[model samples]
Target: MVSPFEAGMFSGPWRSLLSLREDVHVEETAEGDLVLHGRWGDVLLRQPDPVVRGVLNRMSLGPISLSNAVSGHGGGAHGAAAVLRVLDRIEPLVVRTVGRSDGRLLVSVAPIAPAARLRPEPLPADRPIRLSRFAMVRTDGSGYILESPLSLHRATLHHPGAVRMIGMLARATTTAEALGDPPDDRLLVDALVLLTAAGLVVRGEHAAAPAEKATFAEDTDPALAAWSPLDLMFHTRSTLGRHDHDFGATYPLGTGRSPEPVVRPAADGPVIALDRPAWEEILGVDPPLSVAVEGRRTARRYTGEPVSLRELGELLYRTARVRSLVLRQDGEEPSASSRPYPSGGSSYELEIYMTTTGGRDLPGGVYHYDPLGHRLEVVSTDPAIVAELLENARTAADASGTAAVLLTMTARFRRVSWKYRGPAYALMLKNLGALTQTLYLVATAMGLSASPLGAGDVDTSARALGVDWRVESSLGELLIGRPGTSSGDTGRLPVNDAAWAERAAAYLGVKRGG
Candidate 1:
């Protein structure tokens, strides 16, 4: 491998090239002190030497070679070292870049973590290396971006050769092999160095300890073994502490366009307006909070007893009916509402659609609950899809008996995502859990059983409900049934989880039907 320093052109990221981000600018306070402010937030520089100001001024105009920083301040090596110290102090505001020997840009890495500082140095030309398993590459505008969930920085590839070299690192390869015949050898090798420094590349086996090498072997690393590619991406993208994406109520899409309507307007179908009990009646007769909380559990067996439409209405009313809608014209937020269950940002994004096996008053069909009107919009009366939905619920919930009513939960994603960034989907999921818990407690209060399924079929749900899965998709399902004597002894034990486990362990084989 030809060394980066072996009489090659001085056009690579052999040493650090530094610049202040465009948004970052120096500000003067009334007290005559200097402050730096931009995407990196505010940093007050107390009594900074005058040379620091000159160094920053030069960096602000454009990228400056760190080795030649003294030329900008006119003070030689000592001044250059001082400028380097100032750069270190404001590292979060700096963007680091690398270029090819022709001086054409190769790659530029910018800090995403608050404390991240790039130590720009080319990798050993002879060392074999590979791309980190977590690293991903995608096109951005006219160029490409290579990043990883595990890395604190994101690198933008300005040249196709840089992108090509990253592809080559899919398996371990040395810079020599990559730099083959040297038309543009320095570019790829230097780009590899920058990516390696950004924690986006895996150093070769010989260069890494066993613990470090295991990180590249996803299946062998216990910390990463269970996380699938898409899921890990989702986890990092949806939360802070690992990502640089816009987060939380940023309202990325300007509020000019209103959010999705609070309650999904009535779907075209036969709507059965449910008769919900007054709030006074519920408060007057519902079970105590303690009883509902401690007594809830999963019950599979359903008696032949039919659940009345009024009872179903009561369950919906108690668990998910939209109590009221508040619209804000200021556009900071859209129409939000109060419900029995809680939601992040009050973005009640969960919609309830039910499939029942013919209750005494309601027939077996797919029906979406119109929460505002306290009614069911008959979605599909097709027997095949209806049975499939219920059967799928039974299997998913591990129930022996047929399900009485299967409630499929779908989310109008835009409702939450439009207002909240990053954790929008995650917040919707938390809403699902809260809503399901409300269902469980409400069912326990009504002497019925609620079984929350771990998964649901979006395709079948969309076909059954006659709605586009992309616009509105299923996130969860729950099987509601009338508990029978033969059902599993689930709720018979109070919510003392540990005590129940202990007693069951001691008496398991002794009971007749244990």
Candidate 2:
């Protein structure tokens, strides 16, 4: 008995319908329509009313497996590693087919790549069974079933008019050549999405494993946390707390000095020059005077001059100021929020710290900037705090000198965990990057300098700041000063001095040289 699809192939205007590819010419015949005259099966487009179906003029595919790709160490022996091991042993394969204008049938064969290795184990008998393959004899009849060696997770039918499509794809000699039939990019993509989602097919491409980077959470210590404190005194001055403080119990100074050396003012600052003709040419088309987007050119060197307190205030305000109120309707009440920078959930978990040397009417002490009121709060007028801040930043980074370091601490995961559950770490890092970029742009516009530091000592820094261990701290150091010649730069540390700092902590018999 002819199937509904096979009957429809001959009875309907399947001949006039379009071929997915513009190059392929569609022809009618006693057997049906011809799409491609391949070595194996002939490809045909069968009209089944609403949805046109791509059917294999001949063939059937055997059992297939539905499984996730294994990656990394595979966790444990019984996890991904075990699964891939089993798949390697079975070595299941698929078959393909083609049709001709003369009703001639051709079939081909190919092997699936080793994307995964599975471990052999008896599947639970009571567990639900998974079907790997099925064939449609007709549009409405019970299709022929092909048992899958591995259970199928789920199944989806594309068009009731086409059953041979799955078999054609499964058995194809070359997956890419078969997919090349339908040239419509969007349609092809949609079809692929559907098949993959239903666990009916696998793509040829493979994805890379996730990245691994060192983080504060990986550190082993009692006082250490992801976040630490930022005081500018020692950072701006190139010295650790070589003094005493009443804040907490100080550990014996270690022999090793902080690896982080303070970044000194550039002697012959970065030189930036622009091509006048190129600048004018682009500007002539759509001149933007309000905001200039300059090309990547060396900026002119600066003669060191103390940045005024007013200028610092403006920089903070422009970059980290709360512009306007963001209101959203809550369950029963309306919530109004504010932020210095745009936030994913308005968590505003970032805290800003400032370390300065010289400014009119402001002493060279570390200060915390308050975004809410657009003001600076004095954390401690003591110069020793700056040393403490720099020590923390250097310890966290295990590197050298950075001027004007900003410390950001995460007080509570609950701040955003409720809205963005398990992925809070990713979101937090993104927020940090944004905050750094905002500061960088503001510094650029103000003719100052800034740098973002990824490494720092969170444990010691947190202890100094009197913050809880759970709070995560990060060092974002910015060096701001008048650019000048190398000879005249006072902030420039001698190479020997810089080297000495690295070993100072160990020499002092404590974590920091101070």
Candidate 3:
């Protein structure tokens, strides 16, 4: 449907000028007379006639009739003929009868011409301007939205004049001159300046590159090449510090829309009960938090020693166990449970799966960690799938030693998307970072080797676990095992390891040599 602003520009006076035929020809002859060949037949406009010259100059402002021009001078046959000749010089001219004005017949005359070129100087009152191809314009209920994707600039125009200006530009390229006198000259000029600065509008002869071709020419990532307008719009709008949207409301948990069960139940698979140790028992005789922080480093190489089932259980319990479930019935929002790690909106969305390569008292397979029950639910018994998962971890770490355990972290998107608008994926990423740090600290305190993987194959993990990629997708992976006695380098040491070690030792109150 056409908007009111659009109807005014397209159905009003501007429409007559834009709808003219393009084939009509106009040219200057050797005698300096302007010759036009159109539907009305050939005619010649003599430049020497003063009235004809005035009419031609007025045509630059828009279409004008010879009768109007000659009536002001003197209504004579000879002067009318001269004015008609000048009108014919503009190809594809049209004449229509209208209401009588001042007891004289009024004729509306329109002449079609090529769109005017954008000019660099202040727009002339007679010329028209248009939006460049790179400019994207749309209107919502509130106001008009203008965006230049190439320049990465956006503007929201709510003022009536500004909206009308954009509508005129869309209907046909027109200048401020063609718009006539403005209600507020300062406001009009300021709006135009801002639009010009944002690359939203162009005047004179300048032509901008098309948005699609320009975007493809500059974008480097192949994954992003497949993005659609909706994809980009969703990504930008949902992220923080952009346009405003509904936020901070504790949306009620609708009937049957409660969060997914905290833990997935194992139907018939073998459940390996996990031994949970108290925090006090685990911290006994261990290094202080400062020492643990100082000693924490990404371990790329393991000792080729098998990690015990008890150690795996301890790691999961410390980093991701569900501590308690809170239920509120005091007329406030619905209740939510709490976990060891922080989550956005108390929406603990992360779930853990593990692949073990025949660890002590543990079989080699893929299993899901039931955080609520503190047990492992067997997902797959295929050794090849287990091997592939461990291989991916080793490749990600670039280490020769095999990883005893590979932790795959996946997020339940609906948990956060239910309450949040745009920052759902961002919140998941933040949750992953917090979970990784928790793993790092827990591993450090337990004297186990741990390294976060930089990359993982999502499809491979999904196939091995028989989980739907759309429902839950892998976000991160971490390799955990016993620490090696030797240097156990993966040939990927930090460039400034010596300097870092010295600084770390000083901060931890230990001598460098010691």
Evaluated with lDDT, which candidate comes out highest? 1
Off by over 4 Å in 2: 1-117, 121-305, 327-340, 391-412, 485-514
Q: What is the lDDT of candidate 1?
A: 0.74
Q: Model 1, range 390-447, lDDT digits (tens) per residue? A: 8888888888777688888999998887778889899999999999998988887676
lDDT of 3: 0.61
Query: Per-residue lDDT tens digits of candidate 3, residues 420-471?
Result: 6557777888999999888887776777768888888999998988888887
Clashes in each model (backbone N, CA, C under 3 Å)?
0, 71, 13
Q: How many clashing residue pairs, candidate 3?
A: 13
Each model's TM-score? 0.84, 0.37, 0.56
Per-residue C-alpha lDDT of model 2 across residues 221-254, encoded as one tens digit per residue:
3433332322222221122122111122121233
Using lDDT as the yardstick, the better of models 1 and 3 is: 1
lDDT of each: 0.74, 0.36, 0.61
Rank the candidate models, highest TM-score first. 1, 3, 2
